[model samples]
Target: MAGILSLVWFVGSVLITPFLMILLCIVFLASIGKSLGVRRLYVKLLLIIFEFGRANIETAQKGSNAEDTSEEDEEHIEEISPLNSNATNDIKHLKTPNGLKKPNNGYVPNGNSVISRDDKLILVPEPPFTMHKTDETTDLSEAKDKCKDYDLCNIFDYLKAGMESIIEDQVTSRFEAEELKNWNLLIRTNRRYEFISWKLTVMWVCGFFVRYFFLFPLRVTICFFGVWWLTLCTALVGYVKEGDFKQKLNKYVSVMCFGILSNAISSVITYHNEENKPKSGICVANHTSPIDVLILMCDNCYSLIGQSHGGFLGILQRALARASPHIWFERSEVRDRHAVANKLKEHVSNPKNPPILIFPEGTCINNTSVMQFKKGSFEVGSVIYPVAIKYDPRFGDAFWNSSKYSMMQYLYMMMTSWAIVCDVWYLPPMQQNEGESAIDFANRVKSVIAKQGGLVDLVWDGQLKRTKPKKEWRERQQEEFSKRLKVE
Candidate 1:
């Protein structure tokens, strides 16, 4: 194939007049002249060298005729080899100039042996010139003394780093837009991405002010009133009818009322399989935010079970604890998981009990996926009812990344949005299959919920998603330092 391609290329080049001129000139000279173009000069040079060599040989022969035969024979006898192959091999390697010696090749290098003791030991030829070198060793003590005299710090280096960081972050910022999209409903409808998209910088700035100054006051007022109204009615329910049939009615009613108030802010709420909503039994739901409670309880009230969150939400949970059957398990009791399970079992002792709502993902996810479920809720021998909740972030992101904002901060951002839209799916009751362990049962329930709600099923245990803000701070500074170096 190579020969064929070469032949075709040669023919193509010969077809051109300039290529033919160069090619034919060389061929014609080589065929008819005494020598080819370069060969003609080489022949003249060789003849001159031959003449010089012959004259030198004649002069050497005339000079050597006076030399004694006896001295020549004695010198030859001393220099001759004695059938030693080892000495012959050394001679072979030594004859080849610039041959490097291996450390353990079982041969004396450069004939550094008795046979070549008188011979020069020129292993490698001396270099033409010595390289000019500057001293590079750093003296810490001297440097410290110098620094003390003039306060010589790395401020210049720091300035260079910061400048590089600013430039690098600016240059690459355009490409780091929300490249992964449409993976789930969350990503498909994320409007908050305006803050990140390079093309939407101006629009985002405008939206920010419009969101805060124009729409902030009205939403906060509504949220403020809803909080108090929900609190009072909840207190009234608990006080009027505690542990009776009327209490159940009041609890469900209060939840529905809270849901209605929340729905007023969002302007959109819908649910499926409202009939399968349980009055009492273990109820597990996918959690995305604190608002998940209101969404799930829109139709049926369920007692929440989890550790209490801090801040405004924590206070709200505490207030609700006095009114509803929401149980905040003590997280410090690490040695008493079995005791905790027993307590959980006791909570659902009654069939008429308000169905205990368990957000198995202990922490909220970004609605990209349903995170792993804690098996404690499924461990109880009750029929586990599964619910899937999904939100449309086209109007607002309901997933609260609390690290960047407080509860009030997040809620204000949410309420002032165009609207919060969501869907609830109350999947069919999932019972533990024969001999299925609690983890297996929980996973089964989680998979069904993820499938039903168009959510991704992630394998991470949500409990392990605790924010390491302190560690990440150090890492962030290091990352910034590295970015600066990269740009430089």
Candidate 2:
């Protein structure tokens, strides 16, 4: 009877255990979904709160600054005005850039000059006026109609205008009307909706942390799924959104897995000389666009060492760094002059992670010519591998082409343009022997890069080649010094 009971119990345990395991898995996945949903909701709330607060603060600050500026302008006007008690009656001609002459004779009660009160001159701050009310229902036509009456009014009319004259003067003096075209270009580049969406998405993902204690396990699951979901969303959204090549590439990678293509292409193109690869050395390349980072990472030529923007982005990069051994430098930390150099030596000395890629051109340029290379990257005693990249005509005007357009604008240009292609040329490794200066090494590498990429004319020699100088600066200076010495 005891043996029969034991057999029954064993059978029950085996049957129940599998059912329990399946139940647990279902619960875990459900909890994860719930956690992610909550986090996203929280993020939206937080963004709304922060945006309202920021807008209020900005508005207040701008108001205060304007008041201060108005007071200062009043003092300046008084100082500049010629001493004639009755000069206010005499029509004083004020010459404007557009050849519009204004009578500056009337002094408002507050002692400010009167001018036309168009929205461009008064209510709106500057070009591409962003001060328009978000609500379309708010009618500004009445205010605009009142503005035209400024021509008929006297001193009292000018004083009634209040900040209008001040706003106009500030806008005219500090902001050029001609710059509106460029400002419009900037607006197009940084598409408002795309930027806002990205920020909100990032925020929503982070909001889950607030409830981590109760939802820790679920949060982890949510994170796993949310990443792929967000990536998909961002990709679809980015593809539709206009931007420059780099911006589009970044958006494509972040939202979808399309970046893998760019990576594969770069890896295939960059010379992979296992035998010639330096055990450890500085890898220097031309800065065409920010996408250049993606190219370097895909090539597996050098470990990235730079500031890490924490959060999901940080986690993704950190995971990649683990495989590639990335060294993260925080922006807040004081830069140790020798620290990076020493680190490079250590990494190169090791069997793993031999090459460190550096963009010696400290900042991004239009890619028409190579900018002056910064000296620090060359200081690492290892051989320098100079890489030069040239974009195809399809991307000529989009990639590292101009500062006038934003990332989105550039991307749009790329989409509309012909097939996007790039040429990557890697020069032979440069070794620094004893007593070699970083400048000399940089110049040597620059020369090699110029020749390989057909960009020699863009370098210093190009200037000398066109419009030959009669004498060098040193020679001219010496000639001047000789004459001075003779006089003495």
Candidate 3:
């Protein structure tokens, strides 16, 4: 019963569709003709349709007679061979070697059947195609409009011929402009527009206002309160407990709190860590923002090693130390680079401290690409664990462009968007090859993280960021201007 109704419905639709289309077409043509002041629109539309039909007909007839072999055209013809009909009946299965699924008795597959024979089976290539030439014509009404504007001057010139010379200079400029207004000569195949500085300035100003109004309050409410909470908990725990166990416990608590803080900003956070990997190995990860530390800490307990930046970010770093043994080194103490390396080794060597965490990319990258690892981190040569950090910019960019945005500004940008999210992969510990220099080992580990993190591997050494390029315009080099210097 349903089938009969469906068939009736289908037939009724088919019969009524053409009539409805015809009515719509008449109304459309009447409107077009009314606007154009003529009923000649049909002629123009039909000509366009005919031109399209002719092009399609030419293309369909391109290679239809490819195999013709008349004696007059024999010079272009080549010998042809037909494929054997019995070849498929003799096909063999690959599993025959294991005696599990035998090929059809006495039949075997021949892979050579797929190979094309150029001499014996020469197929004629299709003829080159040409596009239909257009019959388009430009309207001349604009030129008439220009003449109307000039007609007023003509009235004055006829009254006094000497008066025309006085205004000739003004008239000539307008005439020259009008003459080439519709010309297509010296065609611009491509356009190269130089930077418009004013537009950029306007965008920056607008962004600042947006951040201040929309995102700043939410970020401060979350980050400011969250930091104080972490500090209070860590201070309470750090002072009361005294052993290596206490520090590990503090790390575990810090990781949990920070992880929750991370979730507050991001919609999703994906963490992948190898179960059997050691808990206290030195961790080297890609640097995107300060949040990289928070995100990873949420995944596992790790003691952070970094330099303190001035402003709110610096204060957050100091507070983090109360939670666990976080090492904050100063670059000005170049004499202490070696000392810091020793401390990192000591932390990893000790049984009580959480694993040492270091972002080899000293500065924050936008997370679209990776920066080079500091060779100093690799010098420790302990069982090195590489952790890849990646963020989805769909919610908010994870990069901290310190030059343009302070920590306060960046945090607001992050929270105002959808939740901040990241993927953390604790890759296998890199096995240092014999005679491998510290630089090579660091690069090798860096490559593993970049691959696992799904990021572009860069050759830039982040450690050199302090001295080279001067720090005045560092954000440009990191994001926009250094595009040419990027490694594939």
**TM per candidate:** 0.53, 0.40, 0.51
Which of the predicted structures, 1 or 3, would earn the higher lDDT when compared with the native? Answer: 1
TM accuracy, model 1: 0.53
Q: Name model 2 segments beyond 4 Å from true.
A: 1-280, 310-316, 395-419, 456-488
Candidate with the greatest TM-score versus the true structure: 1
Better of 1 and 2 by lDDT: 1
- Give the better candidate number (2 or 3) by TM-score: 3
Query: Where in model 3 is the C-alpha error above 4 Å?
Result: 1-219, 276-278, 463-488
- The ten-residue window of minimal lDDT in model 3 covers 174-183
lDDT of 3 by residue, 1-488 (tens): 99999999998798567545643443343223222322234334434533443343333333343345234233322221223333222222121111111222321211112122222101121111111123345334433344333234433322332332232321112111111111111111121111113343354355446445534444445455566767777777767658867865676667555643553363355567666244776878888777777777665777777666677767667777776777877767545877888888888787677778787877776565566677888887687888887765433556676767776677666665434556778787776788999989988988888888876566655544445534644564234323322333
Q: Native-vs-model 1 lDDT?
A: 0.57
lDDT of 2 by residue, 374-395 (tens): 6667776666877776554311
lDDT of 1 by residue, 1-488 (tens): 99999999997676455533533453343223222324235334434533443344334434555365446544544454453545544444332211223212333322123132112112111111111122446554443343333222324444444443343321122111111211111223233333333333454466557556644654554456566766676666667655676666566555545653563354456678888887788888888788887776666667777675776667667667766676676667634778768867887887766788888887767775676788888888888888888776545567776556787777765766656667888778878999999999888999999999887565556644454325664675556434423411
TM-score of 3: 0.51
